[model samples]
Target: MRLAVSALLLALVATPAAAHFQEILPSDDVLPEGGTVTIDLVFTHPMERGPTMDMARPARVGVMANGAVRDLTPAIEEKKVDGKSAWTLSDTLQEPGAAVYFVEPQPYWEQAEKKWITHYSKVIVDSYASGEGWDAMVGLPVEIEPLVRPTGLWTGNLFRGIVRNDGKPVPFAEIEVEWVNDGSVTTPNEAFITQVIKADGNGVFAYAMPHAGWWGFAALIDGPKTKAPDGSEADSELGGLIWVKASDMSAASKLLIKQ
Candidate 1:
C-alpha cells in the first residue's frame, strides 16, 4: 500500500489516544424525494468534534447501486477541514435504490504508535426509499456486514453487524464506536469520547445509539508487519469502518399518557 506523503507526521511524542475515525458522511442518509447528496470524506475524532487530520488523495472511491459499480474517483473534490486535507463527492440520485459509497484511503503513518493505518470506510444512502441494496457487501478486504438494515433507523435503535476479514468472519474483533458530535453535547471524560466494544464468538457486535446523528463503527485488526517510513519494522493496523445515521422518532409516533 502506498503511504500518504501528506499524513500527519508525528514528530513529537504525544499522549496515547485511540480516537481516530475515518468518516464517509453524506448530506442525507435517506432521501425519499431523491435529489443531490454531498458526501464528505474526513479523518478525525468525531466525538471530539475537532482536530481533523489531513487525508491524502484516496486510492479509490466508488459506489454500488442497482447491481452496478460506479467509479467516483474523478468526481471527488479536495475540501479542507481545520485547514487540513479532505474530500467531498457530490452526486444526484436518479435511481430508486441504495447507493453504498466506499473509499480506500492511502495508508497513514502514525509515528505516535509506530504503525501504518489503513481504514476502509463506507456509508449507505437510500434513494427514493429504495431498500433493496443496503445490505450489499462492497467486498472490502476488511468489512462489516450489516445484519440489521442500515438505513431508516430510528433513534435509540440497536444496530447489529458482523466483522469480516477477506469474506470470512473474524472470531473476535475489537470495534470502536463514536458519534458525530455537533458541539451541542459535551463529555465529562476522555473515556466517553470513543466507545469500545468487542465482537462475540461469531464476530457479531451490536450497538444501540442513544441519541440522534451519525454513528461510526470500526473493527480493527493487526495487518501485516512491514517496514515503516524510516525503514524500520512496524506493525500495520487495518480497520473496517462503516457509518449509519439515526433520527428521532416523530411525535406522532408517540403515544399519549393517560392521566
Candidate 2:
C-alpha cells in the first residue's frame, strides 16, 4: 500500500495544470489617436507565462463599434508563441467610441482532462477618448457584464462584474483571475498561480488587482455534454473570459520638478 501511494503522488505531480485562460488582449484599452489597435488572442496560463496551447482557427472574430458588429475573421493572422500556434488581429476603429472586441475559438480538446473547452473571450478599446458604448454586451452564451468601467483603472481598483449565462445571473459562480506576468514575478507555490474567487449571492464578484499589468478574469460554467474524440460522451467547459488592463498612477502622485 505504501508503494501504491507513492506512485499516486508521483503521478499527481507529473500532471500539467488545468487552469486555462483564453486571452483576448488588446495593445491599449483606451486608444487616444483613434486608429489601428493590435490584439493578441492566445490560449495559455497568463500567470505561468508559458506552454501556450495551439488554438485552431477561431469560429468568429469580430468587433462591436458604434452599435454594429464587424466580422474581422478575414483579417486574422496566424502567429506563433513559444513555438505554438496563436493568432493576432490588427483592427482599425477610426471613430470616437468604444469598441468591444470578442473571439470565439474552436473547441479545444484536452486529452489530459478528458473534456472539451471553449472560451468566449472579450476586451474593450475606447477610441479617441469617446467613452460611449463602453458597456456594450456581446450577447455571448456566457459572459461578464462589468459593473464598473473596465478601462482607466488604477492598480488597486476593484473590478466588479456580474457572471451571466444565457442572459441570467449565475449565483455563486466560480471565477479565476490571473495577471499577465511580465517575467518579473514568481509564485512561491501552486496556490498563488491562479487566484480563484466566487460570485456573491447576487451573481456579482469583485477583485482588486495588486499589480500594474493586464489581468484576465474567467468565469467557467459546465456546458452541455459533448462528444469526445473517441466518440464517447465527455464534459464540456464553457468559459466567459474578459481581459482588463490596470495602470500605475505614480505620475499622479509625483512631485513636479521646478522649471
Candidate 3:
C-alpha cells in the first residue's frame, strides 16, 4: 500500500502544468456594419481545447463603446461545454467605434494547483470602419492595455501590450501565450504547449503569432490570499487575458493584387 501511494504522488508531480486561460471569444471581432455580436465565455485549457471547467456567473460583464460603458451581465445566459458550465451573450454594436467587452469571472477553485483562479478577460471588436477606442481601459484588477490596436490584425503582425495591476505597470511580469489548436498542428514536446515570455523594464511585451488562429495572452500575477471551500488557505492567481484572432493572407488574393 505504501508503494502504491508513493507511485501516485510521483505521477501527480510528473503531470504537465496545464495553462488555464479565460476566453471571451466573439463570432466576429470586426463588424463592418453595425450588427449583433455573439460572445462565448469559457474557462479551459485553450491550447488543447478540452476539459472545460464550470465557469460561475461573472461578477461583472460590460462593454465600452463610443465613449460609453454599459453593463451586460443581466443578458448573459448559462450554458454547458463538455458537461461543464459556461456562459454566452449577444450584443448589438450600433455605434461605429471599437467596442471593448470585458468580464470579471468568479474565482474558480483548481484542485490540482490547490488555488483559486480569477481572470479578467477582454476582447476588442470594431464596427463600421470606426478605428477609435481600441485601447480603452475598463479598470480590471489586472489588465493588458494594448499598445497596438487589438483588431484588424494579420497573422504575422506583432501584438504589443503593457501588463498593469491597479493601473500601474508591473515590471518583469510573466505572460503565457498559446494558440488554440484546431488539431491541424502538433507539438513535439511539452515546452511547445505554452510559450512563455516576460515583460521588459516598462512592463511591455510583444509577440508575433506565426499561425492564423485565435491566440491567447495571459499575464499571471499573485493576488490577495484567499481560502478554498474546504477551509484550507490557498493562493489566488489573477490572470489578465486577451484573445486575438489573426487572419491569413490568401495566396490567390495576393496574386490578383494590382500592386
Candidate 4:
C-alpha cells in the first residue's frame, strides 16, 4: 500500500500547475477611429508567463471580416520574446465591421504528457463602431461561439459561449480560463492559475470576469489519436480558444459640452 501511495504522489507532483494556451492578443479590440491593429502571437502558460514554447510556423492564419475571409498568412513575421520564438502581424482596418483573426498552429510535441497539443485560437476586433459580425463563426475544428459581444466589455461582465466541435455543440464540455498576467496580479496557489468550468446541456457556459484585461477561454477536447514526433502513437489535445478583452468600468468617462 505504501508503494502504491508513493507512486500516486509522484504522479501528482509531476503534473503541470496549470494548462497551456495559445494566445493571439491584439492592441485593441475596439477601434474608435479605425487605423491599424498589431497582433502578438505566442504560445505559453499565460498566467505564469514562463518557460515560453517555440511556436512552429502556423498551419493557417487568416481573418474573417466584412462577410469574407482573407488569408493573412503572408503578414506573419517572426518575433522573439524573452529569447524564445514568437510571431507578430499587423492588419490595417480599412472597413467598418468586426474582424475575427484565427490561427491553426502546428501540433506541439509535449514530452511530459507524451501527447500532441493543437489549439485553434482566435480573437475579434471591431472597427469603426461596427458590431454586427462579432458572433460570426470562423468554422474551426473546435471553437467557442460567443453568445455575448466580445469587445467593449466591462470588467464584471459575464462571458458566455457555446463550445462547438465540427459544427456541433459539445454538451458538458470542459473549459479553462486564464488572464494574460501582466505581472500586476499574483495568485495564492496553483488553482488560481487556471479557472475551470463546464458547459451545460446546451453546450453553453458562462464566466464572470472580475478583473480587467485579456481573458482566454479554452474549450478542451480529445482529438483523434495521432503519431508523436518519435513516430509512436499518442493522444491529442484539441483546444478551442477565444480571447476577449475587458475594460474597467472606471475608464468610462462623461463628455462635457462647452456651454
Clashes of each: 0, 0, 0, 0
Stretches of model 4 off by over 4 angstroms after superposition: 1-17, 254-259
Candidates 1 and 3 compared: the better one by TM-score is 3
Instruction: Tell me how candidate 4 scores on lDDT.
Output: 0.92
By lDDT: ranked, best first: 4, 2, 1, 3
Clashing pairs in 3: none
TM-score of each: 0.90, 0.93, 0.93, 0.92
List the pairs of residues colliding in candidate 2.
none
Model 2 lDDT tens row, 1-259 = 9999999999898765659999899989998889989999999988989779999999999999888999999999999999988999898888899899999999999987899999999999989977788788999999999988888889999999999998899999999999999999999977899999999988899999999999999999999998999999999999999888898888435634322
| Residue-level lDDT tens digits of model 3 in 1-259 | 9999999999889878799989999998789897999999989887777678888999999998877899999999999899999999999988799999999999999988889999999999998757888999988999999998888788899999999999999999999999988889888877898999999989999999899888999999998888988897999999999889888878436766956
> How accurate locally, in lDDT, is each candidate?
0.91, 0.91, 0.91, 0.92
Candidate 4 per-residue lDDT over residues 1-259, each given as its tens digit:
9999999999899766558899999999999788899988899989887668999988889999987999998899999988888899999988888999999999998888889999999999999968779999999999999999999999999999999999899999999999999999899977799999999999999999999899999999999999988898999999999999998866554322322
lDDT of 1 by residue, 1-259 (tens): 1344324334222334657899999998989988999999999999988688899999999999988889999999998899999999899898899999999999998877889999999999999988878889999999999998899998989999999999999988999999999888899977788899999999999999988899999999999999898899999999999999998776425543332
Candidate 4 minimal-lDDT segment of 10 residues: 250-259
Better of 3 and 4 by lDDT: 4
| Candidate with the greatest lDDT versus the true structure | 4
Taking all chains together, the TM-score of candidate 4 against the true structure is: 0.92
